[model samples]
Target: MKFKISTGACFIFFSGLYSNLLLPAMELQAQNINIPIVSQHNALVLQVDGNKNLSTIYFGKKLLDQAEYNNIPELYKQGTDYTGILNAAYTPSGSRNLLEPAITVTHADGNNSLDLRYVSHTITQVNDDVSLFSVVLKDPVYNFLVTLYYKSYFREDVLEQWSVIENKEKGAVILQKFASANLYLKAGSYWLNQYHGDWAKEMQPEESRLTHGIKTLDSKLGTRTNLFQPSVFMISLDKPASEDEGTVLYGALEYSGNFRTDLELDYQNNLKIISGINNYSSAYTLKPNEVFTTPAFLYTLSFTGKGNASRKLHQWARNYQLLAGKGNRLTLLNNWESTYFDFNENKLAALLKDTKKLGVDMFLLDDGWFANKYPRNDDHAGLGDWQENKQKLPNGIASLVKEANNNGVKFGIWLEPEMVNPKSELYEKHPDWVIKQPGREEYYFRNQLVLDVSNPQVQEFIYGTIDGLLTKNPDLAYIKWDCNAVIYNAYSAHLKNQSHFYIEYMRGLYKVLESIRAKYPKVPMMLCSGGGGRVDYAALQYFTEFWPSDNTDPLERIFIQWEYSYFYPAITSSNHVTDWGKQSLKFRTDVAMMGKLGFDIVVSRLSDHDLQFCKEAIKTYNAIKPKIWQGDQYRLSDPRAGSIASVLYVNEDQSSAVIFNYLVNNRYNEGSKMPVLLKGLDPVKKYTIKEVNLYPGTVSTIDALKVYSGDFLMKAGFNPDVNAERPSVVLEVNEVH
Candidate 1:
């Protein structure tokens, strides 16, 4: 058999014997081949030995020349490990390999061992910026096949990998464990950076040093999978991790269901990373001729530190994963915090008027507009019934949409279709629609039960719910799709075996989302699982932005946004000003402007001075929205390290920039003066800096007329006057013509 390898415009062919069993060691030695998947800045080289065993030979900075591959074997010679454990590219359970396997299966005839050997390979150029390389492997003893796929985003320095496992045996094969990708790195002292938080507080960065054991980050919440984000950064301690100067390896799983990422530092100092769907209570049974594919694991290797790695991932996401891409996101006013559940048509009309008066782009009617029988007056009832409450809306949702549009403001609504409260009309009619184990009492979370999305009927119902809303009101500008509860008593009556609940549920959710996206392609949607719960690439592909946290307090948001920016771009982060904290209006607006700016406060209730400040802040945010959404982000200071946090954003052409400085707390005797160093600016360009969005009586921090060279601003950074009264400032820098 001939295997064709294509690296860019170059192609090579090599001959190998096709077999169902492992070839003899001597015969296989001559057929060994090295495959290199090259990106713009990195290369991942895989070696298939004569015995058909595949392993990673090298994965790091790009090779200068193809000839450099010849020395890799000699540089890292094979060891004498008789147990057949040498960082096999895609390890399977069996063959005396003791390390964690990427795949574990129980085959027919009660045989549970699997030893996959390389069968064939192919490479295809997907586009100018992307390429796909696939390798097929099969267990010599069983009619089982596993195809590993690697897709390289060449220009973005990002690689995505996933596995497809097919069962060709007569009887059903049970798959106990399956990982999307496995990577092995040479022994080194490494530090792992991960994000951990709860519902109202998400994306809190935590760093730890790796030791000689297994370190795992996983989430089994089933639905709100991001309680522990399915992403991490590993940096070598040799070159300490900094914003822009270190070797950083980032891996993020695209799955939104139960997921796990394991980092193992073995006795030999070798490191292994296994990331994909969590195997806890999710053993899938594959029938004859059936195939199961894992979610894609996205990764990038950066030699220039966490910032570079983040930019690469962000570029790739905008190019492919995110639905909104680099487009502008709308700034809206969400009414959840404004009115909670007590509002009528007159109240909503007043909010709509405020939305237009305040120059907000959209007015969102959140949570209380739905349901007729149960009234939806609080969190306890009216979840599953997707209808307008006559008492609240009076004239219905179409009227509200018309009113907002007539006022030159867009309209949006919120729906939690994947959840149903026990007091809801839909739940009362169909109790079996929820996920509950047979003959067991159901567990309630937030007074609601998780809809059995794994059931086809439930999927259809969810699709219909959104479809009805969009169809009835075509002018509805946005949607806030929420899933407020996690799966409990997880059992899928639609499935014969209950172990497939998590995987099937995710599949079902995706199916509904796909259907919706296909129809309402232009409608922008926001994914919110009580805030940051559904923050994964799989869901982001369909939504425009996400609520980073339910805690809209400016101080808490400073930390949340800082950590979130390390992976997700600002365009996808929906930050809103609220009345939840003691921060002043200017402080709240300055913090929210760092991301896609919005508001969740009752505008009419604001003091006259504060109301005028909101109008001016909205105007300023609109003027600089492009720089914040599409510019390169530089985190100048970390809130965790000090009492102040700062961030800078510079446009692509270096024509414009914005800096946000936030003071977390007031120090009694110390002066509130700190240097704000800039990054990603043209050293030769002279720019004018001005403080924007200042309240009527607030003190100014910038001259608003002085021009300074970028080099001077970066080297001799300017000091901002951040005091207790004015705890934050937004500096706008425009290149002087």
Candidate 2:
């Protein structure tokens, strides 16, 4: 192996075997080897020492000149006790470092101490705004190699990193832990912000101060990894982090399976973050010449505050991470919450008629539509059997699609392809397909067993389940893919080593998704893992949007949507108006309009007054849908801290904007007025404000005929009425040409 070092006006190449002997003599030359991975507003500089170990020198705002790299001081300690505190770019399990290791391996000779040193590096400019960098590291005494890859989206100020490990030894080695990226930050007071909740209450924000210890945020549930999302914001505590001011660093792991993120504030006060797949009961064995790759870890730094960090991620996701991201999301009406499993073909047709009358873009026949020997009247009977229930449907899914088209709307169906019920024919025929441990009883969640997707046959079955549905009904317009169970037994019968189940399952799922995407490229699919359980970037790559939660009560959703917008874009969050609570129809409609608008309520049951409100709200939402879908979002007030929640969306050109304010709760003796400051608008432009979606007798706080300058509106925010009778407002702002 050879390594290349580029210094000022000179380049030196050396063989790997002779590096140790020649390094001492050329210490000055080696110290000058700096590789700076730069994005539009941030830079991560890696330096190679005389010992060939890689260390991070700087990671913050962009440095304009190469000389700035040399001016950055490296942290040092003179005593042996503090030697392990040095921030090695990527450390292995060894005595040299006492902190958490990025990769831990036990060799064939029973030696677990392994040291990794820099070998070679390469940089490739994929485009004007994207660059890829890779560094090779290897153990001095073993034939184990790990290659770290970094990709930078310059325009978005986002960076992604992952690692690939290969073993060439004669015997197998046990991989105890493998992390995708290891990031180091200089000494500072820090605050860690994370999202955590369960089931219908997902994405609740929790912030805490970082102290002198290790903080681990992880998800142990194999499938439903959203018990706690693998993402966080580390805010520098010069002061409290707000929307527009303070330094913030954001990180998210792109894995739908079990994940772990570690934030360690070392004894020396510096911080180190290790993030990747969780290593609980998942010690993988890499055989000779075999390789394993980890999921990508994405991160970005924002000096302007947490809001800018969120925008950076949203910009990157819309442009590269999302499927059909540039396309418009449809406004759908679903039947699950309305009728559950009690609806037949005629009932669905009637719903489709109402859906058309309300001007909904599509009618989604969710769940209960597919079954055979065992009817799916409830969640207990039919899951893997993906055929239409003959008694209920009479004709088939094709007939429903035709009915939907005849009603002047599109058709969609819900499917849970990754689960099996014991009473179903598929599970009876192939009992071995379900994940279970031999000679042990299996546990079930939601009356379903997770399919062993790691098996090739299961992968093909999943793909066929989707392909057959779309192929048979060519006019089907959408799909709501859902998973409702977590791995209980956590065993794959087909794999000789059961520890690889989680990673293999994710690989199999992506393979199936890739195949379906290749065949039906235009069909929009929504990811619903029992509602927001599998909300991660890995799944979002193939899905158009995701149901943020099953709890659609507008009051609860105000807090949920506020927390969700911290990292995810509105276009990818599916919000629905359901008959779950007593909130007014207008209030529910206004809340749902903040995201991909949809309805999950029985339209025929609504009062005439409510029906008209729905019609007007949908029309108003469609008028400003373009700006809401592709725009910058500003969160004005946090719902968790108070009774009022406010959000604003501004178009790229600042020509149009929308503001939503909700009085989540009302208390006696409190004022019925809330101030909402607008953001992301052109300060010099004159704009007109209109209160939309109002009932015939309802009153609004805004004077629709009055015009205001952007400067005045932002400086002196307008107040909206927040009484018990009318608790929400949706204001439209357009530049006065």
Candidate 3:
């Protein structure tokens, strides 16, 4: 029997939608909501319960039977319907639904949720290859309107989801909990793979078997800290997952602030996943006519394996989502590790002289350039005061920028506009602009305080300050925006509504970035938060490459870059080489060439031989960037937990290829020679391979091996002796016509 929720509750017999299936419980009349599932060639599919509360069904593969919906009531009773078309039970919310309370509000003077029922849905064409679906639901008792958005596009077998919550009630309603997207998958033995690490050591790929409960990863320290990240993968691991053969479901929240990613399994073995912004310390209060929009949650499923899943993300990032906008071939040098907080007009001129010799594209002038009331010789002072320090750079920024441009290198400067120092003039003027709990001891990180971007005044200050600097220096071609502190007590003295801190803060930050981007549309900038802290899709809208990690230890970087490549293309990563008294320059040069090549070593200090070598390396990076940044990257060997690590990049047409190989333990590890099987190539084509070993200590050379067909090379593999001193080699291969 079907029932309808009229002003006067009544029941009606209906046998149209559910195939005339009989049910024991009083069921709601199935609305004529025809949710269309677009699955071509059985690559991927989506099924929605438009008949009820817009619930999601199998979305990955055509693995379920249609008859399963005939007896939803039986499934509901057996605890299998954690994703019940409209689950309102405690058991469902507790263990099955990833979000604790999909809907929470204080409407009747306390925490209560009125029954939310289905309303309607719509599909709109976005472009030639993309479409959007919006499902509307309403809670009559509380009068809340919830709209769920799902966007599907061609290629990569991907979809994006988010939610919008509006207060349709007469009075204000406190939204205690909300989630962007949730998914339910049939029972299976699944394994979870995720990215985790610390500051300057981000993107450590890890995998572990999923037990029979909730597995969660979150960032509560605000600013999407490196601890618990926003990127993760849940793949069906009947056996071990490989590069090209397994069911892998990858997901990431396009948010830069506090976020949560969870994978939960119910007792019935059904799996549920929820990902969105973290509503940890505050619940947004929505006034009448007010609405809250969550950041986009991107996900994709691949049956061919985890590699294809990663390649899909990489393709999207480079083709559509990159902040660079397109085809940017920029090589640069950053004066941070070499000079730190010390520099002058003369010092910078010398660096620019060296920059031009190497054919470098840009010269990035890092921190300590701006300080009006306080000396920013160290990290403790001069953050908010954006004026140039006359004592350090006697020539104003415009003058310095002109000098760099005269030398053929575009000049860029660093700014921490969203932060303030207690010893700076800006903080002295408006201490209230910083975020701090009233009467609290007030915590500080990196001797700096985070600005309360939620406050309109602070937002304007950040925008105006950076705007002034760029306007003063039109020759400036780049900006390195660095955020060095985690948010705490994100309180705004100007706003009485404390719950809106996260949302408002991010909004303000975006407003400032967007304003700058509008003014300087052609300049390329990097997003850095003490290194690799704010590298997400949300921030990618405004910034170009992101500094992956501060620990440019090339050995450690090999693992870090590999993990990051799973979701992002090399174009969005800026890598640098350091002559850190320990590692050989050759080893570091080869590592830096793997991504956006940057230099941190003092130029004038380098020996004549070392400088010439660097010049040659930069030339190589310049020639190969277009392919490396836009090509299909394949992990030739595991960087972590393996004896040999390698990466391969092949152009879309398979006309060119670049490969890098690193030996884990040349002298001590089990393998004396590393054998690597190249992948993602035209197997029938013959190829000419050339070797360039940066490390002079390496004994084995690429010239020792003979070129063969891609098929033979992939099958027979190539072996390189693990030189006792340096064990890294870089190879360039071209298709031989």
Candidate 4:
């Protein structure tokens, strides 16, 4: 079904269809344009004119096949109407190229810069669902060549693009800015949806109308810190987007270090959005023949609104981004709040037994595991010292691991391998290994400093520490990897140009991850930036799950999950059920079910009633875990706009489903009530729905069992009493004849 532009012509099959869908590929247009083109069915079409300049043909439901061959210097001023794919310093609008430049490089002469000139392009069919479009761009003036790659998954309604910039001059070239991908769209009423947050709050979805000038989100932090993740964004140009209806252009960058997402409206009203690395220093020097490749920028357009847009992103991530595929979502329990930095072998053994009693699958020992040499009792002392704290774990982690396995729990350890404490033995021995300028005042977050991971020695230490622990403990099934601080001094001892530190830092971090994964490919890993800091498909490529935020508040988590669901899979979320102070087991468990479900509070200390609730919830979670991972996720209710939040998951085959509805707040005397419309169901079939008492005890007017047509369930909807302040209901819908 997938073919390339062989010989001289290529075929495009139209694929936008659903209720009253239109324009099937059967109604084909034999007509071909002079310019060569590549397309993903009829939904998207791309072309390059005679100048070897790329242009958009079809994006989403719009067609932009018209070519502007006439050389109008003024048109370049009117935004991206006639501008080529790559804008450069050699252009007529040099220094004022408002549109996002694909690559920025300093010329050898120091005055004469480079403009992107077309070289050649090739389309290679990689697989049935994937096609790679590679275009070569040259900055002849600077002797620089950039190879742009666009990989299209025709079936998934997704396209990813990245560029490799190579310096060909005998001397070095100074790289200023580089974007993974730049896109131009016909402009109109534009609104940008961005997920913004800080520390305990991450992925709080927010939107605003975009006006003229530029709207930007850039993260200068070493990691894709949650404070500002300029990595994923959704744009609505012509109308205010809704959950289920409206044109939405969704994009996510695959890089984790210093990123920026730029959206600008030109003088002509056209829009240009760019996603790529943030030039923290604009001093990255590239040696001749050395290539710098940008991260893959993945994007897709959905006519059916943000929900569908998110589904495509989530699907792409699960299918192609995760380190492991469709892994089990075991009921994991963490001993963080339970015993912050205070726990020993005895405490852990008791907790492990409680986890087994509650049917918890994994026991993640969070923080304070190493460095008895300098005593890592808190955040200040002992980091980077990857030795066992003999006092804390007198017997080491062997007996604990063995006991955990025997208790039917997978044992995972927490480690912050990318950071070091000045008070630790490791830092005292190798003081220069930290990321700091030689003569500048050093900065630290959480009493920890980042490692100049660019150094080969540092990378080796990190890799060995992690690989050694995993190897030593054969039963170690998971890792809670944490990076607590951002780059401060941004200097590397081995590198002269400090600007390249950001790029090399990621390279070194990724190298360490690769080394560890090569040794323990199947082990599930968690990437935590203290709690919620680092996020992006590039980091997601190595980590199995992410801690959304340290705050486990149920009401907050619903909104966080809603935003994350669009770009990341539930499996990648470390949604822990935490009884942080007054939270009940039911409310916490219900929210955690939306992600890679886990526990954080002390289990053994819980009352009998609470412990019973935990046992029952895990049993329910185990049965429906697969469906949650592989199902089509739907946001039945928006938590922000209303007091009720609801989510539905339907199996790929549509034969089974699980729905979770929670009352976010107590506003009205009456129960929080709404008709939750279901999606991704076979309307032709009948289904039996049963109300599951997942929380152990709850009051609801919803019937115990009922049979309904899928059509009725979607159109008429199911109404339940979401009255309790933290009340919730779980529905098990089965296709029954």
Candidate lDDT scores, in order, read 0.82, 0.82, 0.70, 0.73
Candidate 2: clashing pairs of residues: none
Better of 1 and 3 by TM-score: 1
Tens digit per residue, CA lDDT, model 1, 1-737:
11111121121211132212222223455656877899998999988887888888788888889668757766754455555555788888866678778888898777889999888777766668877787889888899998888889999999888888889899999999999898988745778887777877788777878887788888898998786564545545444588888888888888778888888887666788998889999998888988787888888888888888888887777778888687878889988888899999999999999999888899998998888899899888899998899888889999999999989999999999999988888988888888888899878888898999989899999999899989999999999988889888888778887888898888888888878988998799998888888787777888999888888888888988888888888899999998878878788888888888899988888899988899988888889988888888888877777667878888889999998888886777332466767888899999999988889886685798899999998998877666665578788999999
- What TM-score does prediction 4 earn? 0.90
Tens-digit per-residue lDDT, 1-737, candidate 4: 11111111121221122122121212223432222223342244444445444454444453344343222223344544344543221221244354556556776657534566556555666567766666666754567787666777766778777777788888877778777777767645888888777787788777898888888888888764555554788888689789888888888777777788778776677677777778767467777777777777778887788888778777777777777747665567888889999999999999999888878778888888789779889999999998889998988987789999889888989898889998899888898888777888878888888888889999999998888887789888888888878777778887776777887887788778877877787788888886678877777777888888887888788777877887787778888888753545777788888877888877767888888888877778888877788788888887877878888889998999988888776655644556778888999889888766455465545565678889999998887557755377777889986
Spell out the clash pairs found in candidate 3.
200-550
Backbone clashes in model 4, listed as residue pairs: 13-42, 14-42
TM-scores, all models, native as reference: 0.94, 0.94, 0.89, 0.90
Q: After TM-score superposition, what is the CA distance of residue 560 in candidate 4 from its true location, in Å?
A: 1.4
Clashes of 3: 1
Q: Which lDDT tens digits does candidate 3 get at residues 1-737? A: 11111101110111232232122222455432234444331222223333344454345454355454333433433443435542231112222344445555676356454445556555665555555666666665567777666766556556677777778777877766666777666545777887777776677666787777778788877653654464555556454568878877778777777777667766766566777777776687777887777777787777778788888878766655666646584677778877888888888888888788766888889988888679889988888888889999877888888889889899988988788888898888898998888888778888888988878888888888877877787777888888888887667897888877776777778777777877886678888888788878778877888888888888888888887887788888888887652557877888888878888888878777787778877777777777778888988788565777888899988878888877665456544254688888889988877776453233445563455798977887766444545466777888887
Candidate that beats the other on lDDT, 1 or 3, i.e. the better one: 1
Cα lDDT, model 4, residue 607: 84
Error of 2 at 176 (Å): 1.2
